[model samples]
Target: MNDSKPTPSFWKTPFGIGATVIAVAASIYLYIEHRNHLLALLPYAFLAACPLMHLFMHRGHGHGAHGHGQRDDTPKRD
Candidate 1:
């Protein structure tokens, strides 16, 4: 029986490294060229995040199931 190690993922290869370098360089160039435009949108981005935060933050709370005058089934501790 022959045993061999698995090949590395694409991101771990030389070509992937080159591509990543290029992508990061491009991103830096773009940000430098449009810093003002991007910064101007920061407030709008924060506003958009508010609704998303509310939606995700309440997901585990089981909202509307135990609140609003409804009696909770959990036992009260002394």
Candidate 2:
């Protein structure tokens, strides 16, 4: 007699199923009620702050890929 149970796929898992249900419900509610607010602010907010956000995003990496102290071979100038 077979005793093993079948394995569950992604949405069959508890967290996955719960998250899917929540997302669908939230989307339906938003579309039925708050869609105008979501639509109105999203594009303007994205456009206004995107460049400043990008500029700051590039920082904190600090000098080159090999750290600030180490130098790799690149043919020394003579």
Candidate 3:
């Protein structure tokens, strides 16, 4: 049987390194130039994250047949 590994993706190649360097430089430039505008929106970004956090974090709460303040009396398995 042949034993060959798959090729690495573009993000793992030299081009990806160049792209990452450009992206970091651009981000640093933008952050420096738009410091005031970005900082001003920080509070709104947090306020918008509240509902998103609740929606994502409350998945296993079982909001359907299992009512609130009730415990699951089922036996535990090893």
Candidate 4:
């Protein structure tokens, strides 16, 4: 008796084809309906991304050694 399962064909499967059609249709509809609104928000999105980029980019920096050659406040015993 054979015991082999059918392999999935991603883009050719029913769900895959349906999802592609739905995505394409939604993209077309949104572009036609809200293109101007989306374009207006582009500059604000860029402005917000600038500070986030700097914070993330410099997160791994400014970590130098400290407490070198500095005297402690407590007195030393003879």
Per-residue C-alpha lDDT of model 2 across residues 11-75, encoded as one tens digit per residue: 89999999999999998999789988989888998897989897888786443557666876665
Candidate 4 lDDT by residue in tens digits, 22-54 = 999998998899999988999999999999998
Q: Which window of 10 residues has the lowest lDDT sum in candidate 4?
A: 60-69
Q: What local lDDT score does residue 40 receive in model 3, on the 0 to 100 scale?
A: 96
Cα displacement (angstroms), candidate 2, residue 41, comes to 2.0
Which lDDT values do the candidates have, in the order given? Answer: 0.89, 0.83, 0.87, 0.83
Candidate 1 stretches greater than 4 Å from native: 1-29, 74-78
Point out where model 4 deviates above 4 Å: 1-6, 43-78
Q: What's the number of clashes in each of the models?
A: 0, 0, 0, 0
Query: What overall lDDT, based on C-alpha atoms, would model 1 receive against the true structure?
Result: 0.89
* Greater-lDDT candidate between 3 and 4: 3
> Which segments of model 2 are wrong by more than 4 Å?
1-11, 44-64, 67-78
Please say which candidate is ahead in TM-score: 2 or 3: 3
User: Mind giving the per-residue lDDT tens digits that candidate 3 earns over 33-63?
Assistant: 9999989999999999999999999886555
Q: How accurate is candidate 4 locally (lDDT)?
A: 0.83
